[model samples]
Target: MATSGLLNTDILSDEIFDESQARAPAKRCDRHSHKPIDMYCQTHDKVGCSTCMADDHRSCQNTFYIPEFIRNNIYQSVSRKIQTELNKITKTLAEQASKFKQDKQRLLERKAELLADIRRFRQEINDQLDKLEKNSVNEIEDKVKCLESKIDDGLKQIEALEARVTTASNKIAFPNPYQPDVFVNMKMADDAANVANKYMKDTKIKSTVEELDFKHDRTILTQLEQIIALGSLTEDPTKMASSLFRIRGDKSYCVKVKSDTEDCYISSACCLEDGPIILADHNNKKLKQIRGYNYTVTDYYDLPERPWQVCSISKTDVALTLPLQNEVHFISGEEKMKRTNKIKTDFECYGLAYTNNNLYISDASTSVYVYTLSGTKLQHFSETQSGQKLFSNIHSIAVSKDGTRIYVADFYNGLIVLDNNGQVITTSNGKQFCGAKCCYITKAGSVLVSTYGSSVLQFTPDGELIGEVIKADSEGRSESLSVCCNQQMSRMFVCSIDDNIGVYGI
Candidate 1:
């Protein structure tokens, strides 16, 4: 039915007229356009269509076809711009990192400095604390030692006081056993009275018979009275008994008899040169021996019941005292006889000491009687009041070598110092049991005291206790002490009731 040409033409028309529904929307171009409309393209941005470019967009500055533009340029200029911006951001980040690192380093350095300062300060504080602790410990130890020494000294003083007090109490409480009761001889008295009467009557008869005027014959009348008094004299045991005190020193001692005594207590002793003289004290009326281990001659002057104290004046002359009789007798060693230098006393004497020209005597009357070596009285000082402190008993006496001062040992008070004029200069108070017996002033100006049961105490001239020389045993009692002044030999000798003499070196 149809011809071949007609068929071909129909197919062409069908192909050419294919529907626009299958085509994508055209992109709007805005490359250089002042104004452009968007296109519906999935893969490309809004671009100008060919028609748009030929119309109003042809004069625009950025209007172009997407496909055409892609074909001609590879976007090299934009790529260059983006690369530059990325490089700048990276550099900025690097600079900021560097600054942060520097800041951290500074912080670390400052921390190190602060830590060092703290450590230094801490060390200084620790050092100070350590030093303070050590010093405190040392001070405590020193104080403890001082207190301990003081306690020891105090204990010693207490013991000495107890011993002396006990002895004194015993002496006072017990009565003497040797005291003799006196009775008059009635028969002898009557015979003497008759003889006196006969002589008187005969004389009176002769005078009256002679009638030679009764001129008062004073001499004859006095003789008659003497006879009458002699006739009445009675033999009494109490009067005949010898009132005596005895004190003995060691034999071979340079000083034999301080005074003279018929019988004496003698003990042999050894001591260092310049040691104090050792002497025995006799309170009870007991006959003493003249020599040690040997009964020497018995008849020596009218011996006292007991010689209390003896002092040697020289190699031949000695002064011995019958303290109870209140009398001192001088005797010669060569003749073994009493001298005429005898003197009687009214007070009871306890101790004797000698200076260069005089002798010092301590008495139970609490009086210090200073007398010349020749029985002449010099001065008296009593320790009673503040100015004159009277002691309960005078135990011992010591005079300075220069004779400027005298030291008195008071059984109650410690030690009393008196000037040459018999005035109290100073008193060692607060010293316990310091009243043993004797006190001595050393050449170094130290005072050495021999207490009863205590150790020897040494004191400075100013009266401060310095040290203790020796300690006494619990039962040992010190009686006397003597210092030797032989410049060749420096020694001190102490005597005790144990019948021993101790020697010490300076």
Candidate 2:
């Protein structure tokens, strides 16, 4: 026997082994022994050679010769079982592929629709320009025609007067024998001279060198140049049920964020798209990101000045208003926060909110200013359309998910709701929401307002009070200054002017 557990054929005579059999290759067992696989272990559902069966499958009860098992149709049954499972998987994959094809078709159709809309808008603009051009040209032509008509009339009168003067001069120079004819000519010349003098005095023919020049409306070009895009593409809206009914302050966590000199005063809080909670530590002049169930500060970035409010611009980007610096600073990163850009404001920026590439900033006095992300002022909301003062002291602002409504947390006016145009829509004033500090709008359009007093009030998107979600302690010492919720509204975070952050279950 060879070490490979195979019978050595080198020493066998040519007469003992057929030449073809010795030269042919055979399937060997993939095991310790490189012997031909001739056995099947039904108990273990495996195939191996005799040596492997005896060594590894000794305890297996059912075993048979591989050729005998195949002859009994056992291999066909196993093949059928595998084929059935493969068919199921194939069917599932085919269905998924079909769904993807449908989605692709839908996307193509949407692209076509958007393209058509853009073309239609362009056509409308062209039509308007054409109309304006037509009006201006018509006016210019009318003025030109009027001036030509006046000059034509004056020319005819001058021609008639020239004839009269020529006749009068010929009569005097040639010494006409007929006195009446000469006298008539002289009278006609005198009449012509008087008429010409009156026309010269009455008509402004000398000053008729009018210059017609078109002063194009440069404002139109300026506005067109400022437009970044025709519109924004948004995901299809899904129905989100109100989560206010389930909000309960059942949990609280410390956030464990602090500075070297001062304690954390989280004046503002916002949740990232992927679940991280960002906090603006006003006293520490830092921005902190906390994540996980235990709420630990995973990362933080220091600011040059105290941040009054913070708003999420994207999953990895946040904008914070620096009142002292009169700027809104942008910080971005996932693992570590870094200052990326800043927008300088004309007024002190305090309350901040972002939506549709627009920033809504409150001066913390009496007005809220809207600006593009690039710092172009869009609208100013100091008073209502009726000139009534809109806000006294705006602490925070929140925009509805659809970017159609704005909710302002005014310390004096309570909760003030406005349309996207800054027109007042509704206002809610009550003792519970009197000292409103921060406001957050949920995906379902519900409003959560934290007040200077210890209560966090809840209200409908329309500014109707729902009730208080969180209240003060018996001593009325802790005040909820900022409030925010996760994307799903399953978790709510409220922080006071303290180092700890309270987490609530919804």
Candidate 3:
């Protein structure tokens, strides 16, 4: 009977030893050096054999029975709880990763939308948007990396705790109940499993990511072209305006030239304060008008020479320039315009403009010639005080409402801006008007320029640039010949070298 009982104990011990070995290969005791571990020090989080227990762990607090821990917690509830927390963390991280992908995709698609014309102006804006997107994505990635680091550390701690608990649990769960070895080894694993349990309990895991979002400049989209050209786009956010133009046949219409004369070539266009449309067609040597409402052609008045440019002197009057004859013709009559008188200048007259009851003209000599309503040549600036020529090639001229500033579209030097004293302002040689053909001041206090770059540019009275194209379709068509505004300056007329003209709202 005694032999049978001993044999049964031996078999149980053998089975328990096999399971314990599978969980954790026998570890050396800390105090005993080469001996197998048989005791645990919960205070120090150490595992050891009998000698280690007496020599190192005798005074330790919170000791545990490994056998009880194995039966109660191991291969059961505690391990499952730790795994559930890890899975939750993984699921949360997956959602953060999805957000990162979605944000990157949106930024790339918007970048495509912002790059219409890749000129220096548009190119700069695209680069800014690109930089912003990259920085924004990097910010999100940094946050993700931070969260990932935290999660990895938590996972490692949890994994270490799980392994320690499992090893201790298996040692006690499989050991023989009647064996002295079981009783002796039980002391170490119990405390070790309890220590692991405490770590698992204290390990707090966060499963959510940090905040991520993008804040874009709303005005950047509206003035991206200007920003690209000028490196900045600024405007009064509260200023709102609209046009009161009525479409005649189509939104963009062509002026009637002559009787089936496919030879329509308009050099300049203007709208009088009273709403009559005047077109100066140099090719036909005629000044044309489209009456209001029905837009019916009034008549084509013949000139001494080709009328290269026309500007509204008043609601009932307009000034015309003849480049070949070095002459300016003043035409008056609201309904039917006729050449009232002709004034001769020494230089060939090209561009004609009227502001503050004064007529300003650009001549073939690249000189901005200003005159009174009586055709008296007022003060003209041929060169700056620095001896630099006022302009090398002048196309159009505009003066501020207060008559304190003058703006000239210089084909050779961009937009030449001058103060009341004829001193050069900042706009000269500005890239914004490098290809400018004609310019006019708006009632809303803005200067509008038509450029060979196939676009229109707007500038505040203070010279802040704004690029406002008539349409993307306007590019590469007939070159923009002239830009003019209505009585209120809310409506704009952009005339092409061809008969077709674009009406826009500022």
Candidate 4:
């Protein structure tokens, strides 16, 4: 048998693992039978005298005394054992390294696919915007050209009317040279005209023609007024060429962020636009967000090592309950200063809920506690007997929107429904339905709960278990949960202890 050594963690020897031949009895000389001898008369094998080395085993070059062989060969046994274990260790390490390389390759492929998708979607959007701008400008230019054509037609009509008016005025002001203008304008006539008139006067002595009076001409300017009032023509077309057409106003845009935190271990995270009031878990350290980005690190909240359950009531108000501390601390805003409410309890508080007028706490210590929003203890409800059975350890609590009912997640009792006055409305055993860590109701009235595994189980509000939100993994586990209702950019954020944040679109 081979013995293992420290170097076995690195590798194992092949000779130790595989044995080809069976063991045989040791061959020895008839005399001095107690002494051991090497099978092949090597350096570690025993030789009785010089005659044995020179005769029967003359081909063997080396020989040693029995005691000398044992001392030198002892170290070889240890060396063989170390090499055997080292071979096995190295084999296992190689397998693990191969698996790691495969995971890295898969991650790189996924990243490439996501980048390609983003680039493709971005290009599509840009192309659509370009097409829209081009079509809009083209439409605007076409409309302006049509209006200009109509204006040109109107101006042409006006010019024709002015020309007609000019012709009429000239006829009344100056008659044809050939036509006779008798009596008053005889001195103004030229010499050639007078000679021609004298010859014509003798031929036609009878004067029967009449001269018309030159009155101010008035014409209809209906088309001119229509063109000017319609504003189809600019006072100066050169100045009007640089103006832009007006359009309707644009709509508002927004961005949403969602986050989940666990003091012990952080696993996964998701982002939604404007779902919940998620502040940093600054009890461990300060939270810092990059400038110009949506996230930031604020202040610190002083607390014990473990505060398992936490809830955010508003943008400025947050409640954190601890197991060992047995107290609920209310923190507010970026300052992270403790408010007036520091409710102390003898039992451990697992979860916290806040209504418009009161706060509900699950102690898991025999009953639940109800308090005023300002830390005034109103009452504590202990589990009452039912058919000779008593229930205790109320695990979690959630209040209805209207504060009419309070829902409790019990350890063995499953889900216990209670009225506002602490009376049990119903009880259910959700052994196979719900899990241990956390659960919540979706806007669609479905339930989502975390289990011991890596995934979150989904269920109908009626307690029928549905499919899982995510599957269990060899690389990580999930112990926390969070949801987002309002997202900044049409996406919801989900956070968990899996060290990854998931983003989804509605």
Per-residue lDDT tens digits of candidate 1, residues 1-506? Answer: 12322112122221222233334334334554444433212222233445554564444455544343333334444445557778998999999999999999998998797778767877886797688667867776776677667657656755665554555445545545544311123333444455555644654522222342324436544333322121121234232222111112222222223343223332111111112232333432232223212212222344454555455556445565667778766655443345657776668776666668687877764778888866777888774446645666666666775777777666677777777777677777565655555665554545666675546666554444565566555333444443222112334445444333444543
Model 1 TM-score relative to the real fold: 0.38
Of 2 and 3, the candidate ahead on lDDT is: 2
Model 4 lDDT at residue 411: 53
Candidate 2 vs candidate 4, lDDT winner: 2
lDDT minimum window of 10 residues, candidate 2: 1-10
Highest TM-score scorer: 2
Query: TM-score ranking from best to worst?
Result: 2, 3, 4, 1
Deviation from native of the Cα of residue 445 in model 2, angstroms: 1.4
Query: Per-residue alpha-carbon lDDT of model 4 for 348-383, expressed as tens digits?
Result: 777677767778887764666787866778877675
Identify the runs in model 3 with alpha carbons over 4 angstroms from their true place. Answer: 1-250, 260-262, 428-432, 471-476, 487-490
Top candidate on lDDT is 2
Write the candidate numbers in order of decreasing lDDT.
2, 3, 1, 4
Candidate-wise lDDT, in order: 0.51, 0.78, 0.67, 0.49
Every model's TM-score: 0.38, 0.52, 0.50, 0.39
Residues 1-506 of candidate 2 have per-residue lDDT tens digits of 11321112232223322233232226887774568888767655566788999998898777777555444432333445567779999999999999999999999999999999999988998999999999999998998899889779879988887887776677666656888877877777687778777876877567565575678887676445433356544443332323344555455667555453787788999988766789999988888888666677878888999999999999879999999999999999565799889999888899999998889999987988889999999988887768888889899999886778899999988999999888888888766668889999876678889888878788877788777777654252367889898745367888976778877776
For model 3, residues 17-80, the per-residue Cα lDDT tens digits are 2235233327675556787764545455455576766776677664444443333223333345
Q: Candidate 1 — which residues are off by over 4 angstroms?
A: 1-305, 308-312, 315-318, 331-340, 383-388, 431-433, 441-446, 459-466, 473-489
Worst 10 contiguous positions by lDDT, candidate 1 = 267-276
